[model samples]
Target: MQVVGNALVALVAALHLYFLVLEMFLWTRPYGLKTFGNTAARARDSAVLAANQGLYNGFLAAGLVWGLAHPAPVFASQLKVFFLLCVIAAGLYGAATVSRKILLVQAAPAALALLVIWLG
Candidate 1:
Protein backbone atom coordinates (compact mmCIF):
# COMPACT_ATOMS: atom_id res chain seq x y z
CA MET A 1 0.00 0.00 0.00
CA GLN A 2 2.80 2.35 0.84
CA VAL A 3 4.44 1.56 -2.45
CA VAL A 4 1.19 2.15 -4.30
CA GLY A 5 0.73 5.45 -2.52
CA ASN A 6 4.23 6.52 -3.41
CA ALA A 7 3.73 5.54 -7.03
CA LEU A 8 0.60 7.64 -7.24
CA VAL A 9 2.40 10.59 -5.75
CA ALA A 10 5.18 10.13 -8.26
CA LEU A 11 2.63 9.97 -11.06
CA VAL A 12 1.13 13.29 -10.05
CA ALA A 13 4.58 14.81 -9.85
CA ALA A 14 5.38 13.60 -13.34
CA LEU A 15 2.14 15.06 -14.64
CA HIS A 16 3.04 18.43 -13.19
CA LEU A 17 6.48 18.24 -14.72
CA TYR A 18 4.92 17.57 -18.09
CA PHE A 19 2.62 20.52 -17.61
CA LEU A 20 5.66 22.66 -16.83
CA VAL A 21 7.26 21.67 -20.09
CA LEU A 22 4.12 22.20 -22.07
CA GLU A 23 3.34 25.60 -20.66
CA MET A 24 6.85 27.00 -20.41
CA PHE A 25 8.77 25.65 -23.37
CA LEU A 26 5.96 24.87 -25.77
CA TRP A 27 3.37 27.55 -25.16
CA THR A 28 4.03 29.27 -28.44
CA ARG A 29 4.28 26.05 -30.41
CA PRO A 30 1.66 23.87 -32.02
CA TYR A 31 1.64 21.33 -29.21
CA GLY A 32 0.95 23.86 -26.50
CA LEU A 33 -1.59 25.75 -28.61
CA LYS A 34 -3.49 22.56 -29.30
CA THR A 35 -3.34 21.49 -25.70
CA PHE A 36 -4.60 24.81 -24.48
CA GLY A 37 -7.09 25.18 -27.34
CA ASN A 38 -5.50 28.46 -28.33
CA THR A 39 -4.70 29.92 -31.70
CA ALA A 40 -1.08 30.79 -32.46
CA ALA A 41 -1.77 34.47 -31.94
CA ARG A 42 -3.54 33.84 -28.66
CA ALA A 43 -0.75 31.59 -27.48
CA ARG A 44 1.82 34.19 -28.35
CA ASP A 45 -0.19 36.81 -26.53
CA SER A 46 -0.43 34.74 -23.37
CA ALA A 47 3.01 33.18 -23.48
CA VAL A 48 4.26 35.07 -20.49
CA LEU A 49 1.30 34.04 -18.36
CA ALA A 50 1.69 30.45 -19.43
CA ALA A 51 5.35 30.52 -18.51
CA ASN A 52 4.49 31.87 -15.09
CA GLN A 53 1.98 29.10 -14.67
CA GLY A 54 4.56 26.57 -15.79
CA LEU A 55 6.96 27.79 -13.15
CA TYR A 56 4.32 27.18 -10.52
CA ASN A 57 3.76 23.70 -11.88
CA GLY A 58 7.47 23.05 -11.69
CA PHE A 59 7.46 24.12 -8.07
CA LEU A 60 4.64 21.67 -7.39
CA ALA A 61 6.64 18.86 -8.98
CA ALA A 62 9.72 19.83 -7.01
CA GLY A 63 7.77 19.88 -3.77
CA LEU A 64 6.36 16.44 -4.43
CA VAL A 65 9.78 15.08 -5.25
CA TRP A 66 11.22 16.63 -2.13
CA GLY A 67 8.49 15.02 -0.08
CA LEU A 68 9.20 11.62 -1.59
CA ALA A 69 12.95 11.98 -0.99
CA HIS A 70 12.80 13.17 2.59
CA PRO A 71 14.57 10.80 5.03
CA ALA A 72 12.14 11.41 7.88
CA PRO A 73 8.85 9.62 7.39
CA VAL A 74 6.75 12.09 9.37
CA PHE A 75 8.24 15.09 7.62
CA ALA A 76 7.87 13.45 4.24
CA SER A 77 4.23 12.71 4.95
CA GLN A 78 3.62 16.30 6.00
CA LEU A 79 5.30 17.61 2.89
CA LYS A 80 3.22 15.34 0.69
CA VAL A 81 0.03 16.46 2.36
CA PHE A 82 0.90 20.10 1.96
CA PHE A 83 1.88 19.85 -1.69
CA LEU A 84 -1.03 17.61 -2.60
CA LEU A 85 -3.42 20.05 -1.00
CA CYS A 86 -1.88 22.85 -3.02
CA VAL A 87 -2.38 20.82 -6.19
CA ILE A 88 -6.00 20.22 -5.33
CA ALA A 89 -6.55 23.88 -4.61
CA ALA A 90 -4.95 24.92 -7.87
CA GLY A 91 -6.98 22.38 -9.80
CA LEU A 92 -10.21 23.59 -8.30
CA TYR A 93 -9.35 27.18 -9.05
CA GLY A 94 -8.33 26.37 -12.61
CA ALA A 95 -11.51 24.43 -13.17
CA ALA A 96 -13.53 27.39 -12.03
CA THR A 97 -11.59 30.04 -13.86
CA VAL A 98 -10.20 28.37 -16.95
CA SER A 99 -11.75 25.03 -17.87
CA ARG A 100 -13.75 22.24 -16.35
CA LYS A 101 -11.27 19.68 -17.64
CA ILE A 102 -8.85 20.78 -14.97
CA LEU A 103 -10.93 19.05 -12.30
CA LEU A 104 -10.38 15.69 -13.90
CA VAL A 105 -6.90 16.26 -15.22
CA GLN A 106 -5.34 17.85 -12.16
CA ALA A 107 -7.36 17.49 -8.98
CA ALA A 108 -8.53 13.91 -9.36
CA PRO A 109 -5.08 12.33 -9.38
CA ALA A 110 -3.84 14.32 -6.44
CA ALA A 111 -7.01 13.53 -4.52
CA LEU A 112 -6.58 9.85 -5.23
CA ALA A 113 -2.96 9.90 -4.14
CA LEU A 114 -3.84 11.75 -0.97
CA LEU A 115 -6.46 9.15 -0.17
CA VAL A 116 -4.07 6.26 -0.75
CA ILE A 117 -1.36 7.95 1.28
CA TRP A 118 -3.73 8.41 4.19
CA LEU A 119 -4.96 4.83 3.95
CA GLY A 120 -1.47 3.45 3.72
Candidate 2:
Protein backbone atom coordinates (compact mmCIF):
# COMPACT_ATOMS: atom_id res chain seq x y z
CA MET A 1 0.00 0.00 0.00
CA GLN A 2 2.84 2.37 0.83
CA VAL A 3 4.51 1.56 -2.41
CA VAL A 4 1.30 2.16 -4.30
CA GLY A 5 0.76 5.46 -2.59
CA ASN A 6 4.30 6.56 -3.33
CA ALA A 7 3.95 5.54 -6.94
CA LEU A 8 0.78 7.60 -7.24
CA VAL A 9 2.57 10.58 -5.76
CA ALA A 10 5.35 10.13 -8.27
CA LEU A 11 2.79 9.91 -11.04
CA VAL A 12 1.24 13.20 -10.00
CA ALA A 13 4.67 14.79 -9.93
CA ALA A 14 5.41 13.55 -13.43
CA LEU A 15 2.11 14.89 -14.71
CA HIS A 16 2.88 18.33 -13.39
CA LEU A 17 6.29 18.23 -15.02
CA TYR A 18 4.69 17.34 -18.32
CA PHE A 19 2.28 20.25 -17.91
CA LEU A 20 5.25 22.54 -17.32
CA VAL A 21 6.85 21.44 -20.55
CA LEU A 22 3.64 21.78 -22.52
CA GLU A 23 2.78 25.20 -21.19
CA MET A 24 6.24 26.73 -21.03
CA PHE A 25 8.03 25.33 -24.06
CA LEU A 26 5.25 24.34 -26.40
CA TRP A 27 2.36 26.72 -25.82
CA THR A 28 2.78 28.29 -29.23
CA ARG A 29 3.73 25.15 -31.08
CA PRO A 30 1.33 22.99 -33.06
CA TYR A 31 1.24 20.31 -30.38
CA GLY A 32 0.54 22.71 -27.54
CA LEU A 33 -2.03 24.55 -29.59
CA LYS A 34 -3.72 21.26 -30.30
CA THR A 35 -3.48 20.18 -26.68
CA PHE A 36 -4.99 23.39 -25.39
CA GLY A 37 -7.37 23.88 -28.29
CA ASN A 38 -5.93 27.29 -28.96
CA THR A 39 -5.52 29.05 -32.26
CA ALA A 40 -2.03 30.17 -33.17
CA ALA A 41 -2.89 33.78 -32.56
CA ARG A 42 -4.46 33.07 -29.19
CA ALA A 43 -1.52 30.91 -28.20
CA ARG A 44 0.89 33.59 -29.20
CA ASP A 45 -1.04 36.18 -27.24
CA SER A 46 -1.07 34.06 -24.10
CA ALA A 47 2.35 32.50 -24.32
CA VAL A 48 3.76 34.63 -21.53
CA LEU A 49 0.87 33.82 -19.23
CA ALA A 50 1.14 30.16 -20.09
CA ALA A 51 4.82 30.21 -19.31
CA ASN A 52 4.07 31.73 -15.94
CA GLN A 53 1.47 29.10 -15.28
CA GLY A 54 3.97 26.47 -16.31
CA LEU A 55 6.47 27.80 -13.81
CA TYR A 56 3.95 27.26 -11.05
CA ASN A 57 3.40 23.71 -12.26
CA GLY A 58 7.13 23.12 -12.13
CA PHE A 59 7.15 24.34 -8.54
CA LEU A 60 4.39 21.88 -7.71
CA ALA A 61 6.41 19.09 -9.27
CA ALA A 62 9.47 20.14 -7.31
CA GLY A 63 7.53 20.14 -4.07
CA LEU A 64 6.17 16.66 -4.73
CA VAL A 65 9.64 15.37 -5.56
CA TRP A 66 11.02 16.97 -2.42
CA GLY A 67 8.30 15.26 -0.43
CA LEU A 68 9.23 11.92 -1.94
CA ALA A 69 12.93 12.45 -1.20
CA HIS A 70 12.66 13.81 2.32
CA PRO A 71 14.72 11.92 4.92
CA ALA A 72 12.29 11.96 7.82
CA PRO A 73 9.25 9.74 7.57
CA VAL A 74 6.80 12.00 9.42
CA PHE A 75 8.09 15.12 7.71
CA ALA A 76 7.95 13.38 4.38
CA SER A 77 4.34 12.43 4.87
CA GLN A 78 3.53 15.97 5.89
CA LEU A 79 5.24 17.30 2.83
CA LYS A 80 3.33 14.91 0.63
CA VAL A 81 0.02 15.93 2.14
CA PHE A 82 0.79 19.59 1.77
CA PHE A 83 1.85 19.30 -1.83
CA LEU A 84 -1.03 17.02 -2.71
CA LEU A 85 -3.51 19.46 -1.23
CA CYS A 86 -1.95 22.24 -3.25
CA VAL A 87 -2.28 20.16 -6.37
CA ILE A 88 -5.90 19.46 -5.57
CA ALA A 89 -6.62 23.14 -5.05
CA ALA A 90 -4.93 24.10 -8.27
CA GLY A 91 -6.75 21.36 -10.13
CA LEU A 92 -10.09 22.44 -8.77
CA TYR A 93 -9.41 26.03 -9.75
CA GLY A 94 -8.35 25.03 -13.24
CA ALA A 95 -11.40 22.85 -13.59
CA ALA A 96 -13.63 25.74 -12.63
CA THR A 97 -11.91 28.37 -14.72
CA VAL A 98 -10.24 26.55 -17.59
CA SER A 99 -11.45 23.02 -18.28
CA ARG A 100 -13.33 20.18 -16.62
CA LYS A 101 -10.66 17.77 -17.78
CA ILE A 102 -8.46 19.11 -15.04
CA LEU A 103 -10.71 17.57 -12.41
CA LEU A 104 -10.22 14.13 -13.90
CA VAL A 105 -6.58 14.41 -14.93
CA GLN A 106 -5.13 16.41 -12.07
CA ALA A 107 -7.41 16.39 -9.01
CA ALA A 108 -8.56 12.78 -9.22
CA PRO A 109 -5.08 11.32 -9.17
CA ALA A 110 -3.99 13.42 -6.26
CA ALA A 111 -7.17 12.55 -4.41
CA LEU A 112 -6.52 8.86 -4.99
CA ALA A 113 -2.95 9.20 -3.82
CA LEU A 114 -4.06 11.05 -0.72
CA LEU A 115 -6.58 8.35 0.08
CA VAL A 116 -4.04 5.59 -0.38
CA ILE A 117 -1.47 7.46 1.65
CA TRP A 118 -3.95 7.97 4.44
CA LEU A 119 -4.96 4.33 4.38
CA GLY A 120 -1.37 3.19 4.38
Give RMSD (Å) of candidate 1 vs. truth. Answer: 0.5
On a 0 to 100 scale, what is the lDDT of residue 72 in model 2? Answer: 99
Residues 1-120, candidate 2: write the lDDT tens digits: 989999999999999999999999999999999999999999999999999999999999999999999999899999999999999999999999989999999999999999999999
- What's the TM for model 1? 0.99
lDDT of 1 by residue, 57-83 (tens): 999999999999999999999999899
Q: Model 1 off-target regions past 4 Å? A: none
TM-score of each predicted structure versus truth? 0.99, 0.98
TM-score of 2: 0.98
Clashes of 2: 0
Scored against the true structure, residue 27 in model 2 reaches a CA lDDT of: 98
